[model samples]
Target chain A: MSVPLLAPGDRVLVKDDWPEFRGPAHIRTPHYLRGKPGRVVRVLGGFANPEDLAFARPAPKRVLYHVVFERPPLWHEGEAGDDVLVEIFEHWLQPVPAERQAA
Target chain B: MSTPARPESLARLDRLVAALIAKGIVTESDLVEAQARTDRASPEVGARMVARAWLDPDWRRLLLGNGAEAAEHMGVSMAGAPPLGVLEDTATLHHLVVCTLCSCYPRAVLGYPPSWYKSFEYRSRAVRDPRGVLAEWGTTLAAGCRVRVVDSTADYRWMVLPMRPAGTEGWSEDQLAALVTRDVLVGVALPRLPVALAAE
Candidate 1:
C-alpha cells in the first residue's frame, strides 16, 4: 500500500481539473466540489481506482480521504458553520498553502 | 425438467450471471442465496443498531468506529459491500446524507435506496439547500444547531445515528427501534415518540 500523501487535519483544495479518460469514464469526485477547499477529517485507506475499475482494467490503489467543507462555500445560500463531508481520492486533492490554512 | 424462459428485460442480467457462473466465479446457488440475503435487508436492521447504541455506550462506540462490524454484531451481514460509516447526531449538530453523484447507500443495513434519494432534484437540492429540504420533510432544527451534509461519494457508505427521542426513558430496545424509520436513518427525519408512548 502506498503511504497516504495527506493526513487528518490537513487542509487541502480539490483539484479543479477534470480527469481525461478516453471512454467510459467513472469519475467519483462531484463536479460541484472541484476547486473547493476542505479539511481532511480521516484517512479512509487505499482502494483500487474506480476510474480504472469501471473499465475492467487492472488498477492501482489510491488513498481516500474524508474531507469536510463549510457549506457557505459549497452553496450560495448555505448556512454558516454547516458542513459537507465528502470522500475524496488523493489525486483530487492538493495541499492548501500555509498562508491560506488559517482561513 | 427444463428451465422456464426468463423475461426479456432480464436478458442482460441473465447473460452476466451465466458468464460469471461459466467462469467459476460464482454459482447459480450463490446468486440465489445472495438475493435472499438482500431481500431480507431492511431499515429495521439499521434501526436496531441505533437502538442498541442508545442503550449501550460501548456498542455505540463500536457502531461509530466500525459500522460494518457493528452491523455484523447485530446479525446483519455486510459481505461484499463497502465499509459503513455512522454519522452521530448531537444536540448541536445534525447530519444529512446525500449522494450528489449517484445513489451510494449502505444497502446491507438499510436495504435499497429510496427512489427519491436517487432523483436528480433531490441530488441537486440536498447539498445546495439541506435546511430547506429538511423543512419540507417536517424536520426543523433549533436555531443554534448545525447541519452536516454527508456525501457518500466513494467506497465508504454512510447512515445517520439520529438523536434518541425523549419520553421513552425506560423503553425496551424493540420499542426504541420502533421509533426509527428509513427516513430517520437517512437524516431527513428524526425519531419521534408516539403520542401514546409520550403520554405514558
Candidate 2:
C-alpha cells in the first residue's frame, strides 16, 4: 500500500478507528479525545490498516498514517516518554482545523 | 519485576499441558527434559559475542544484520529456531524487545529472556513508555537517545546488539562477552566497559 507522503512536522490527528492498544487506550485517543487532536512526526510503514480488517470491511485503498504525541499534552497527567505515535488508515481520518481535508 | 499472571490463565496452561501429556502429544518426560535443557543454557555466550563484536566493526555489522548467521560465525548455531533479527542501539535510539503474544526468544544466542520480558507489565508498558520500563530494570539512557520498543511476536523475534563502549583498545572476544550481560542483549541494559565505567 502506498501511503500519501507525509513530511516531518506535518500536523495530523489519530484516526477515530485506530486500534487502541494499552498506550493509545490510556493516553493518546482516550474517550475524551475521541474527536480530539494530534500531529504527524514520521511515516512508519505501509501495510494493511488494522481498522479495515477489524471491521471486516473491504480494504479501503489508503495508506497508514503514523503520528506522535507528547504524554503531558495527550493525557494531561501522563508520564514522560508517553509520547506516542499511532498508525491509522486514511478513511478513519478527517481534517482537524476544519480547513485542511485529509488527502 | 515479575508480572502477575491471571489464575485462570495459569489453570488453562496447566490443563493444556495435562491434555498434551494425556494424548501423547508431548510426554511428561520430554517436557521435563526441555525445561532442564532451557535452564542449562546461559546468557554468557551471547554477552561474550556482543563484547567481541563491539571491538570489531565488521563483526558488529554482521551481528546486527543477521544474528543467527553471526552466531554461527562465533560458533553458536542458533539452531532449532526461526530466523532472528538484531537491532543495534545507537546513542540516539535504544531498542527493547518483547514477545507480545508469547515468549518467542533466540535461545541459542542470548539464552532465555528474563521472566519480565514475557510478563504483561513488560509487554503492555514497554511499547507505551520504554524508558520507564528500562528504568525499572535499572537501565537509564542518555538524554538525547529516543527509545524504540519492538514487539517479538511469533512471526519475528528480536535481540538488541548494543553499541560497544569506548576506550578498550585490544580487548579479546572473551573479555568483551564478559561485559555483555543478558539484559544488555535484551535491550534493557546498556553495555558498559571498564573504561566507560571509570569515566562515568
Question: Where is the poorest 10-residue window by lDDT in model 2 chain B?
Answer: B148-157
Model 1 interface RMSD, in angstroms? 0.8
lDDT of 1 by residue, A42-87 (tens): 9998989998899999999999999999876777677788989999
- The native-contact fraction of candidate 1 is 0.97
- What tens digits encode model 1's per-residue C-alpha lDDT throughout B136-182? 99998978899999988999999999998878788899999999999
Task: Estimate the TM-score for candidate 2.
Answer: 0.60
Which residue pairs of candidate 1 clash? none
TM-score for every candidate vs. truth? 0.90, 0.60
For model 2, the superposed segments whose C-alpha errors exceed 4 Å read A1-103, B1-24, B74-80, B100-104, B194-200
Deviation in Å, model 1, residue B64 alpha carbon: 0.7
Model 1: CA > 4 A from native: A20-24, B1-31
> What tens digits encode model 2's per-residue C-alpha lDDT throughout B65-88?
677788777676567666666777
